[model samples]
Target: MTDSMLKIENLHAEVEGKEILKGIDLEIRPGEVHAIMGPNGSGKSTLSYVLSGREGYEITRGSVSFKGKDLLALEPEERAGEGLFLAFQYPVEIPGVPNTTFLREAVNAVREYRGEERYDALKFMKFVRAKLKELGMADEFLKRAVNVGFSGGEKKRNEVLQMACLDPSLAVLDETDSGLDIDALKAVAEGVNALRGPERSFLLITHYQRLLGYIVPDRVHVLSRGRIVETGGPELAEKLEAEGYAAYVGEPEAA
Candidate 1:
């Protein structure tokens, strides 16, 4: 058994009394990329939100542990402080906050939490510039408002930049591939792949296996009806790519 970085066992959750995730069990260890593929409304985003300690979700049963610490016990910021990052499917627009300011605050906050010295402004800007280069992005993006008036691909790339800055141990990327052109998708995949290492892990929540063609998960899990119905190696994703989810998704066909 591999030592787990994030473990969710039989997790059941709801929002406003409407059950979303039902009995979700997954384990991700360091250096492993685990892809969760399902149709829309299969509770994919819900799982990411719940794991990140987002508000409005109720966990009715089961448990989640990150690095052997009780995940449910941490507040959202606390979770981030502990090196758990969740990249949202839809990046929110912070109208008044410049992307640089938001990222600097976030990076320094996590650093402070970990008892590390904060970066000086110049040092931080240099750090961010290098990350952008790695992601095939330019420096002009740092001057814009966070997700405000940015293109879809830019927003997703910003999310990747944040991931690079924070260097989280576990990254839960919810629909990171949505709305990207082939080039943008490959860039995002390359960013993710660049971050892969023996001490890092990822939970890639996506609807299609196309992104898998780039990142290539170590394991592929089929989620249906709020539960994981099947799991296999990377070949499973190739199979799903060819056959589509209908042949395997046991849930009542998504309405």
Candidate 2:
């Protein structure tokens, strides 16, 4: 088995005839958490969408491998089956679909893909309740429509809850800290920290260093003009927090 969880080589993508990602290269190993910090319109979200196989954006060039497989060839659902998860920056609401029901279906789908037996309702409830308790959430959350009528923090927390239930190997959190207050951010960070282990990895995309202060990524990459121009340890995040991305802007793309 390959030690690399995700590998991107010369990845170039465009949306609506405009190129966003240009010659990007990155590799993430198991048990590592890497953060991508970039200015607005720097293609951070685009990278996440492409990895998740979202529609519309075209992969003009390059290749992505996940677990030694051609990730770009797999359908979005197939990507999820491969233990890849993308936590949306803006989670959508689905009325009439109770969160519990949604989660149960999702978990069963992933389980079925892995050739594991599906969980019965009773077993699933017990399992999910434990996760909720771990995240300091209540039973009431399960009964509500997915993201419907949920506060900002509640929506983000609900995303974390899904992450826990899915138990993905590689989680791409795209701007999860956007619009969150300090307390909410802490709660989300704690939930993420709880899930970290030797078997899983994370790609946290953010604009500020405040989130890094809580999660403390193993490495930080600076995305500029849709390319990763610099990479360093957690200290790099602090430097960006202090000096900003101005220094890296307009620099030549990596060869």
Candidate 3:
């Protein structure tokens, strides 16, 4: 198998007839945690949306290969089946649907797509309970409606829980630390740290460096005007925090 978990080459995307991403070239290897940091309107969220197969964005050029397959060619569900999981910036609430029920259906659907057998309710609960416990979540959470009454912290933790249960190969977390307190941030970070391994990779997009203090990504990329203008180690995040993105903004596009 290829060592690359995800590969993007000269990727350009447009939303509603306006360009958002321009020539984004990124490669994420297995077991690497890469963070993308940029100011608002820098196409950070746009890149995440395009990767997750969300609607309204059109890919005008370039290619995205995940696990050696054409990522853009697959539907969103197919991408999920291929072990690509996207943790949304704003997790939506599903009224009336129990968290456990929602997760069970999602897990089973992915399993079916991968040609794996489905788990019954009893077995599914047993499996998910273990994950929830590891994430320091209470069993009561499973009984509540999905994010219906959850606090901001709870919602973020719930996203981490979903990531744990799904066991995705590549997890794209978009601004997961937004609106979270220190305690809640630590909780979410703990869950993420627990899941890191040689078989898994992460793509974290955030506007601040505070989140990097907890997760400590392997590499950091600077996105400006829809392009990745700089790439470096974790120290890059610290520098950006101090110096700000002024240097990168309004610069000429990379050749």
Candidate 4:
């Protein structure tokens, strides 16, 4: 069995026959938080989508082992069943679905997949309410449609709430800090920090080092084009912030 929570070996992927990820390699151990920072179109989101088994992003070479299983072989829902979570850069709004109802169904689906007993209505409300309290979200959020009419911060906070409730083994935040004000960023970061523990791992994907200032990753990687070119400690994020991705992505791409 593999000791790493997420292991990718020479992964290659393409979308609509155009290659995006090229010979990428990464291994995330349990309890570690890793950050991927790169310029736009660096395949950061592609990597996250591939891991989540999103459609159209095809993996043509290599393998991904998550918790000792071949992650690529699993369907998207199956990947979720195996305890993977992804927070998107642009959260989609469901116009008619109430947030509480959506969250309840999601929680129950995961519970069923994990062979655990589903939470009853009263139980679910209690559990979700507590999580909302912890994230400092208002109770009225439950009655509103998912992401509909929510501010950028509220959408991100809702995602944090989902992370708290689902409690996945690996959570991938894909440019979650984008479009957030400083206050919103810190609030979202706090929610993510609260979930950090020995069994949980996080893969934070962003374009800037601003988010790193709050969450403080164990490893920071610089991805250029479609591959990770550099890896270092938290200081790397600071360096990238100071100098920018010029060395890794070149002057034109960095600008």
Candidate 5:
């Protein structure tokens, strides 16, 4: 079996003729957490979208492997069924669908794909209840429409809830801390921490080091102008927090 949950080698991608990721290389092993920090348009979100198999982005070159499987060959739904999850920076609102129902269907779909037995109504509700409590969310949230009119913090919290329910092997959080208040930020962090285990890994993409203070990644990489310019430990986040991204904001490495 492969030791890494996700491996990206010389990944190059573009959208609308504009290159985004330029020869990026990264490896994520199980039980590890990595943070990618950079200024706006530094390919952090592009990496997340590319990993999740979102459309409209073209892969110019390189490879992405999840558990030794060719990630680029799989569809978006296939990626999810294979235990890859991406928490969007701006979660969308799905009106007319109750949050609980949406989550139950999503979970059951993944379970069915894995050839696992589907949950009954009571069993699913109980499972969701426990997960909600684990995420410090209220029962009332289940009754509301899926992210419809939800506050910024609420949407992020709900994203965590979904992640907890799914129990993915590799989770990519793109700007999850954006627009969250201090209290909500802690709640989101706590929820993420609860899901931390040896079988799981995370790639956290954020602009500020404050989220890193809560998540405390095992490593940090600075992405600049379409590639990772610097890779370091937690102290790199502190340095960026102190001095800002100016230190690493320059021309990307030659391809």
Candidate 6:
């Protein structure tokens, strides 16, 4: 069998002197979609940040291996160059940079990192236009600043569009379904599903199971108190929806 695309062992992390992720171990092979379901303060976002080399978090122990490379040793930009992508819970606004410029820069950066040539103006515009058409977005979107004055659903859709264009090996979506209505949720889910492939994988971090109904996961792991309490198949999400996180993490207040 091929090696695991992402191997995380004994991972521990802290934020502002408070420990958030403790002893997390997970291995996601290629093409597998793994979901991390938990209540509030379960360290789901912490794990994502630690993997993506985000600032302000301290990893006191453990190692993360991405495609057999030392993930933690690299800087955040280096991690992005290595085909790791993180879709934030709240997509930040870039007031001045147009969405087209941001997407081209991101794609070109990754290509340049891998020793590939950057896309010229003609090629980039044509390519990005196809992507927008695929997602049912108008050309007007390319003129708007990134996430500036975008509604919650539009921001999430933009994130999905970015993921499609970048085509990362692994995508970590943190609470992507938050604040989205059912129609927007399904639209985003369809975009995500369209990108699924053998050479790619996904790590979905969510507080609710509704997203799972649209994008079924291969495995579901319940996180509580900075640790993964239980790992199961898609049915685990159903159980979480039915029974809640009480069994594994005690009461909601405790978390």
lDDT of each: 0.91, 0.95, 0.95, 0.93, 0.93, 0.91
Residues 188-226, candidate 2, lDDT per residue (tens digit)? Answer: 999999999999999999999999999999999999898
Superposed by TM-score, candidate 2 places the C-alpha of residue 67 at a distance from the truth, in angstroms, of 0.9
Each candidate structure's count of clashing pairs: 0, 0, 0, 0, 0, 0
* Candidate 5: C-alpha lDDT: 0.93
Question: Model 4 clash tally?
Answer: 0
Better of 1 and 5 by lDDT: 5
Candidate 1 lDDT by residue in tens digits, 143-185:
9999999888888888989999999999999999999999889
Per-residue lDDT of candidate 5, residues 1-255 (tens digit): 999999999999999999999889999999999999999989999999999999999999999999999999999988999999999999999999999899999999999988898898899999999988777789999999999989999999999989998889999999999999999899899999999999999999999999988999999999998888889999999999999887677553563
Residues 46-140 of candidate 6: C-alpha lDDT, one tens digit per residue:
88889888899999899999988999999988888888999999999999999999999998998899888999988999999999888887888
State model 6's lDDT.
Answer: 0.91
Off by over 4 Å in 5: 252-255
Which model, 1 or 5, shows the larger TM-score?
5
- TM-score computed on alpha carbons, candidate 2: 0.97
Each prediction's TM-score against the native? 0.95, 0.97, 0.98, 0.97, 0.98, 0.96
Q: Which residue runs does candidate 3 get wrong by more than 4 Å?
A: 252-255
Could you tell which candidate, 1 or 6, scores higher by TM-score? 6
Q: lDDT, candidate 4, residue 120?
A: 97
Q: What is the C-alpha RMSD of each candidate to the true structure, in Å?
A: 2.3, 1.3, 1.1, 2.2, 1.1, 2.0
Pairs that clash in candidate 2: none
Error of 1 at 97 (Å): 0.9
Q: Give the C-alpha miss distance for residue 169 in model 5, angstroms.
A: 0.4
The TM-score of predicted model 6 comes to 0.96
RMSD of 6: 2.0
